[model samples]
Target: MNEVANPGSSAVVLIGTAEYDHADVERVPSVSANLDDLYDALLDPGIWGVPAENITVLRDERDPASVYDAIRAAARSTRDDGLFLVYYAGHGFPYDDDLVLGLREVDPQFPDEKGLRYPKIRQATQLAIALRRVVILDCCFAGRAGREVLDAGDAVKQIAGRAEISAEETYLLVAVGPNELAKAPLNDRHTAFTSALLHVLTTGSETADPVLSIRTVAEKVIRRVVAAGHRRPEFRAANAAVDAPLVRNARLRPHDLTGVVLEATADVTDPELRGAVILVLRHNDSGALGVRLNRDFGPLPAALDGWRDHVSLPDRLFDGGPVAQDGFISLVRLREHEERPIRFTEVTGLLGSLPLSDAQQSARDRIADLRIFRGYLGWRPGALERLVTHGRLRITDTNPFHAAFARAPFTRTGS
Candidate 1:
C-alpha cells in the first residue's frame, strides 16, 4: 500500500478573500477561485514529487483564530527542520513602511481592525528567523510590506549585502516592484504576476533544474510578467542565501525519462516487457503483470453492481498488460494470504490476477477502490536503466504515497 507521506517539516498556508464588507469595490469570484486553484496546485504530490501528507491548505471564510491555529500547529510540528510557506492574495494598502493585507470585514472607514490585524512583514521576518520561510504577497501596494525605505547609499546595505546578524532564512516575492502598482486586468482571471507565476511553474524549460532556486524562479516569473504587460515582480531576501532552493522535492526537467509504451496489438514478446512507469500492457503477452497503473477498468459486471453492498469496484475494465486488449485483468488484495503470485506496479502495489472474476470481486472488496486511466506509460528494454544511469531520471528512495490520488496537485505558495 502506497501511503501518503506526512508533513514531517514543511508547511504551507494560503489565504485568499475578496469580500471586504466595508470596502466600496464589490467582491469577485476570481479571488477565491484562484486561491482554491493555488491550494490544489500546491498539494499535488506529482508537483513536488513527494507524498501529499507533507502539505496543508487553508482557504477563505476561515476565522482568523483557526487560521492562526493551523499556522501554529505547522510551526510546532516541525520545530527545527521547518520550511514554511505563506501566501496572501487580495487587496493591499500601504501602512507606514509596511503594507496591510485587508481582511474580508475591513472597511475603508476603518481599514485597520484590531480583531483582523494585519500581520506585519517584520513579524513575518521575525517568524522566518526561527525557520526557513518563503512569503508571497499578491496584491496592490505589496512592495511596501517589508522594512522602511532607505537612502540610496543605505539601500544597498539595508536591502542587499547585509547578510550577517539578522534573521537569515526569510525570502519574499511581491507582485510589483517598490512604488509600482499591480494591475488587475478585467479579462484575466488572475493578477498579471500570478498568471505569469503559474505559467512558469507549469512550463517545462530546458534550463529548469530540480533545486528550484528562489532567484531563478523569481526571475522567470518577473520576465514572464513583464512580457505579459505588467511591472516586474519584487524579490526580497533578509540575510538569506539568494540562490536557496524553493521546493523540498527534487526538480524534474522535461527530457528526464520516457514513460511506458506498448503496442496496441497483442504480442508475447520480451521487448514489450519493460518500463519503469508502465504506459500500456496486454494481458495475453505478460500473463497480467498485475496491478497496472494508467489503465482504466471498464464497466463493472451487472450481476455484481449492487450485489456486493459494502465494496466498490472500478467502473471501467482494463487490459492489465500490453498483450491482451480484450481479456480482463484483475487486482487482488487479500488479508489471509500476505503473499501472492502477482507483479506489483510498485506505484500502487496491489496484486494482479488473470481474468479471475471471483478474485477480482474479492480484491475489489478488500481495496474497495480503483483508479482508471485512459492509457498507461511505459519504456522499452534498457531505457529506464539508461535514464537512471545518465542522471536524467532520479529514482527517489522514498516509497510512493496514497494521498496523490485523493486530489489534484496543489501549490505550496501562490503569487
Candidate 2:
C-alpha cells in the first residue's frame, strides 16, 4: 500500500444524534451507530491517515452553539491546504428553500433558527482555509446540501487533474433525494446506507488501485444500497472536486525490507527495475538506503576530469533514486597502496567511499577503482521492506566484492 502523506493537515468533525426532544418527529434508530461505524473507520491507521488528536465526535449535542463551536475549533486547528471533513448522520430535511440538520433539542416551532442550517455549514466550509472540504450528510433531503454547495456546472471527469493552489474542492454525498426519507431500518446497528458503506470499505474495494477515493466508495455504497431497495443516493462535487484517496486497504499493503537484500522477482512491475539486482547499503528504523549497480549511463560527466584514469569505472555514472539530483555519491574499490591524503570510510576490506574532492586528489597515475552515482534511491523506513514483501524485490548477498560495474536500480517511480 502507498503510505499516506497528505498535501496538508487533516481534521474531521463527526456529528450524530439519536436523541431528540421534539415529540412530533420520529427518532432515527441508527443515527448514533452510523457515527460509530464511521468513527471507527476514521481511527483505523490503514484508512484515513489522521492522528487521534485531529478528530472530534459530537454525539447528541443539544445546542447549535456547541456544535458550531466544536466544528470551528476543529477547523481552526487545521493548516491551509489541509483536509477538513464533516460527517452528519442524524435528521435533516428541506426547510425554507434550504436544508437543516437537526439538533438534539430540535423543535418544529422554529426549524430555521433552532436547527443546524445547511447554508451555515456550507458557508463555513467554503470560508475555511482548508484545501479539501468534504461534507457527508447521511440524512433526508441530503441532495439539497449538494445543491446549496455545488455550482451549476458539469462534474469533473478526472480525479487527478492538474491542481490549482487557489482552488478548493468540496465533495458532498447525501443519502436521499431532496424530498425523500433517509433509510433507518429497525433493529439494525447502522442505517442501510452506512452499512453498505462499511461493507464496501471492508470488502468491496479493488486491490489494483493504489488509492481509494471517496467517490469510489460512495459509488459502491450507492450501488449496494440501491440494490437492497433504498432510494438512490446523491453525490455532488462543488467548486473543483478532485479525487480524495483517503481510504486504505492493508490487505494490499507493501512489504517491509529492513536490513534485507532485495531481489526483483520476474513479475516486477517496473521495466527499469525488472531483472535488476540491488545491494542494501542501509535499512534502519528511520529509512532505507540502497543503490543500483547494474545501470550504467555510458560516459561520466566532463566535470570530473581531474583524475579519470585512476578509477576502474571512471567513465560510467548511474542515476540513483529520483530524489535530490544535485547530490553525488560513489563507491570506490580498496587496493593495497599507500592511502591517499583523503578522508574515506571503509565498508569492507575491498570497498570504500570518499568525497569527490578527496577522490580527485589522488595522484594522476594512482589506481583508484570508483563508481560514480548522481542522486540516490531512498525509502522512508519500511517502504523498501514493503516492496520486498510485495514480491517486487528479493534479498541478495552483501558481498561488495563484485565486477567493476555492479547492478543498479535507478530510474524508478510509484511501484
Q: Give the candidate number with the greatest TM-score.
A: 2
Q: Flag regions of model 1 displaced more than 4 Å.
A: 1-7, 49-56, 62-66, 114-130, 148-167, 240-242, 248-415
TM-scores vs. true structure, each candidate: 0.56, 0.59
Writing each residue's lDDT as its tens digit, candidate 1 over 334-377 gives 33344433433332344223234444444344444433332232
TM-score of candidate 1 relative to the true fold: 0.56
Decoy 2 TM-score against native: 0.59
Q: lDDT of each structure?
A: 0.49, 0.68
Best by lDDT: 2
Candidate 2: misplaced stretches above 4 Å?
Answer: 1-8, 151-153, 157-166, 254-415
Q: After TM-score superposition, what is the CA distance of residue 139 in candidate 2 from its true location, in Å?
A: 0.6
lDDT, candidate 2, 309-331, per-residue tens: 56666556775545576877776
